[model samples]
Target: MFNSIGIPGLIIILVIILILFGPSKLPKLGRSIGESMKNFKDSTKDIMDDDEINQDEKATKENK
Candidate 1:
């Protein structure tokens, strides 16, 4: 989707966001977005780890 949105496109989007949200709100908005991204990343990692553990358990049982 964003494959075509290069540096200029990103700059334009940022400018628009700044205009809409203003400088003061930008920091708060950025912090919230960062936190959300971190949470999403952690959740995905936990899910992947669970899948690996389950696969390992299945393999061990099959070997026995």
Candidate 2:
């Protein structure tokens, strides 16, 4: 279903975002989104790291 969105759909979305945010605000918005994504990913990685899984043990379990 997602793959069905082609160039036209992308163009429409781009136009909408441009109209809503305007050209001047686009870069600022992009940076904010990037920072938010980075923070989210960083926090997620920290939580996942706390689980402290061993790669070798996981591989052996998967092999079983």
Per residue, candidate 2 scores C-alpha lDDT tens digits across 3-48 of 8998899999999999999999999999999999999999999877
Candidate of highest TM-score: 1
Q: How high is each candidate's TM-score?
A: 0.83, 0.76
- For model 2, the superposed segments whose C-alpha errors exceed 4 Å read 53-64
Q: Give me the displacement of residue 53 in model 1, in angstroms.
A: 0.5
RMSD of 1: 1.8
Clashing pairs in 1: none
What is the C-alpha lDDT profile of model 1 across 13-32, one tens digit per residue? 99999999999999999899
The C-alpha RMSD in Å for every predicted model, in order, reads 1.8, 5.3
Candidate 2 TM-score, C-alpha based: 0.76
**lDDT per model vs. reference:** 0.97, 0.91
